[model samples]
Target: MKTRFWLSHLRRVSPMIGLAMMVLAACAAPGREAPTTPPTPNPTLTVSGGGALQPSPVPPTAAFPAATPTLPPPPGGFGSPACENPYLPVRLGATWDYQLIHETTDTFTRSVIEVTADGFVDQDEFAAGAVRQGRWQCQDGNLIYLTPGPVAGSVFAGEMQTDVTLESNEGFYHPADLRPGQTWHQKTVFRGQSTLEGEIVVETRTEVNYACRAEDFETITVPAGTFDALRVTCEVHFTTSVAEGMTFEIEEQSTQWLARGVGMVKSVGQTEGAPPYTIELLSYRLP
Candidate 1:
């Protein structure tokens, strides 16, 4: 599942009756069939007055009150402000689970992975598709090396902790896309259990994948609910892209996120001229 936006221009919008009438009118008026060029697309864009955009008040690493149904972030005594990467904020000696969702145009997949960080030397990973449990070592905040296999008598391999150098505090959105040094306003607008809750973001990139994404919104009106979150009627915007060695770029677009506590939890994305896809989350576990 790739959460990438694929924008495509409609080669045809169905019926040609309206276009045919225009062609006939042109021919009757000036003995011409209108220049043979196809009509161009004129997107009606609406910019913000306060220079505000949807996904309002988003930080580089926006934090949220995710379900601790299984995904709990850090334990007591190690409590601190949200880090760029949420995973780092977890207790060093704690064991946790992280459910990741990858979405493409046609398919949406879910993966549940358990992580036990016992001060590094004995880091272990249990995943659904894995043939055996994987082992890792926390070599500081930079390198996460593999040391052992879950299955007995297996060889050790090395790789980054999470494929991506995802610092625990990093925001899912690219930090560079944001306006730097600009003092913008931010506040939690709603809070509750997201009827639509599951995976948020993952660090894998691939090509030839199905993708889904949200389309649009500005400010969402949150309703009442029994959610532990501080915000309500919250808005969630997600973007998906496959960076399989190819450079894919899409501009920042705003859309509505509808949720009770979390207003609208939309998964929207756009890439070049591909069809945008949406992949919903079912469940998740955090450290």
Candidate 2:
């Protein structure tokens, strides 16, 4: 009877020992995951400008600032003091010299010879021995160019040998009629014919179209002193045709500053596929 009681006690203790061994095996498993620690938060940075600490605003990763707009001059703000048309003073015997800034340095001069009912006759000479004669006129308060006629004893008289003529005329500036934001149009045509070997003949024609706008009034400085000037922007389209079945087209943009009584003080020109060039007044003489 004592042996039977001891066997029953051993059977109950064997089940408890099996459960404790299973628990120990689960805790000692090789693939079990470890507990993770929480991450710490970062503190914000503040900038001090001699005041209380304040969080700085985040800057944009990629952005550009907007351009500032230029203000226009007031009405009747700046102009030539002595002339009715301030942008162009059509005084006879007046002259101006300009420096051309391009690949090579050059000089250009324009001189007025005679005053007509409409405008004045002028001559433009370049340091490279090129010469152009033209007439400038005021039509309805707008400055215009006319097909130059023969002058009795001028350099234009020599041009008669070349058989070149101005087929059409155009106006470049209309300062009297233009207010800020106003625009105007101009068209000019030139035709020429030359004979080679007394038999071969060559004919050529050139047409230029200009769209000009009175952009704004601003103070500009150049080799000369600073001046309050009217700014004009122009888009120029030029086409040329040859009788030999060849034709081509060109486009350029230019900006000009005209001060009162000073004509063109500065000009900047840019053509497609070419470097930009500028012409600025060095000195001027006016009657």
Candidate 3:
């Protein structure tokens, strides 16, 4: 499934709603009236003494401890102090190259990701140099996407001009450890203006609900190499309200295969009403 639902919006949405949907990837079926109730505050956000936003410590869930002992990081490992999951390494100077293939289009794009001090940057050089950056913060061993706004790296990005202000965000991007059947969640709300061809088309409010679970281990091969990898699946739901009195609901599902120290090796994703696509690691480099 398309991890970012908005990529399909341009093809299916009306002119007025098209830009709005692309901003949040809410490119799916229309839904009921927008809700009037305000959203609850995120439990993961807390104010520190300096008034900076901090992620609250997530207490361990005893129900699902690591089925296997956590693997030790390599000397000067990529993930080191900030990110803990062995499947995803986060450290400066590390980089990964991937190829995203759209089956329906029979076309492919090249993506290059480089790790930075704070998080990482992803650039799709073949897709008009489209770029997406993410910020990561650790909370009690969990890695959180600290930035509060529309997630970057959507396939639909670069299609419209969007100005979004995030209202709230809470959730862990990755847990300290992964065990078969382990699960996690994230929630975000954002309001934005989407413009098309230099004309403001619609105002939008979007809420995203994301969840993931660890499935099993498998040996997968890509252009890079073959290795034992953990399979993780995620379900993403989007609820969006447009100023023109429209609400859209979208669902997307994605599966990722992560290697012990190399990170994500392959991914398969599908969005509602869209064809499936695959992404595979082409190469990688580490410091």
The candidate that achieves the highest TM-score relative to the unseen native structure: 3
Give one digit per residue, the lDDT tens place, for model 1 in 45-78. 2235743112322333322233222424423332
* TM-score of predicted structure 2: 0.61
TM-score of 1: 0.23
lDDT of candidate 2 over 157-273, digit per residue (tens): 111122344554544435453456666766655554333233223344556666777777889998877988889888776666654445656677889898866778998876644
Candidate 3 stretches greater than 4 Å from native: 1-52, 55-67, 103-124, 146-159, 196-199
Residue by residue across 198-274, what tens digits does model 3's lDDT show? Answer: 55555676777778888888999998999788898988777777765568777778899988777789988776656
Give Cα distance to truth, residue 27, candidate 2, Å.
99
Q: State TM-scores per candidate.
A: 0.23, 0.61, 0.71
- Lowest-sum lDDT 10-residue window in model 3: 1-10
Which candidate number has the best lDDT?
3
- The residue pairs that clash in candidate 2, if any, are 80-260
- Error at 167, model 3, angstroms: 1.7
Q: For candidate 3, list the clashing residue pairs, or say none.
A: 1-269, 1-270, 1-271, 2-270, 2-271, 6-25
**lDDT agreement of model 3 with the native:** 0.57
